[model samples]
Target: MSWHKHLDTSWFRSDYAAAAMPHDENGCVTGNYWLAWPPYITDDKSDPGSLDKILRRRFKTLEAAMAHVDKAWPLGEETT
Candidate 1:
């Protein structure tokens, strides 16, 4: 069993911006998943590029990506 075996390639958003594994013409999960933020990256009005630095900008697994996202914005922590 693998991550792709249970998921499809679709760009969706949650507390973060968008993230998904890219797919090939044959509809296969071709590579690692990518993460992205809105054009205006200053979510906390701190540093616009800070979040990207936290993300490492890539992931080989969805769980890893999610773990990083959690690190980026921890529970009970308020950005606003």
Candidate 2:
């Protein structure tokens, strides 16, 4: 019942570029996810499935990693 369990790690393989559009003028564009690691950090766009590697590499298991993230940052009230 953690965030990682709910994640489809397959989403992280290809890197993603920030939207070409600029962030809000206040720089308050919210509810976004970004790279905390590589392949992600690289100019090369991440493969959609590469995120699994990140979880496997960092948390040893998807559930543990996801739980940590959830504790640190719970989902928004309207998130679903």
Candidate 3:
């Protein structure tokens, strides 16, 4: 005989695995599942004259990152 089981596994996993990283020892991020990192710069200068392009992104939550990805297009949208 064969048996099947229905499970609610959605709670166990996420599309972005990195979102599950352990929070700080203080448990701040654990209380609120949002991790904030320092704003990264491409170069040493605050406002560089170099033509080389630089890209930076900040996400308040995983959903925000996914939303940005979904809105991104080949030609780039007016807002992301």
Give the alpha carbon lDDT tens digit for every residue of 1-80 in model 3. Answer: 11112221111112121122224565433433322211222344443211131123445565553334334321122311
Ranking by lDDT: 1, 2, 3
| 10 residues in a row with least lDDT, candidate 2 | 13-22
lDDT of 2: 0.31
Question: Could you give candidate 1's per-residue lDDT for residues 1-80 as a string of tens digits?
Answer: 11222245544334333446666787787766655333235545445335655255677666665455455555345554
Q: Pick the candidate with the highest lDDT.
A: 1
Per-residue lDDT tens digits for candidate 2, residues 39-72, read 2232333532245533333444434444444443
Model 1, runs deviating above 4 Å: 1-7, 10-19, 22-31, 36-40, 43-56
For model 1, state the Cα shift of residue 42 in Å.
2.4
Give the root-mean-square deviation of each candidate in angstroms.
Answer: 6.7, 14.6, 12.3
Q: What TM-scores do the predictions have?
A: 0.42, 0.28, 0.25
What lDDT does model 3 reach? 0.28
Per model, how many backbone clashes are there?
A: 0, 14, 0
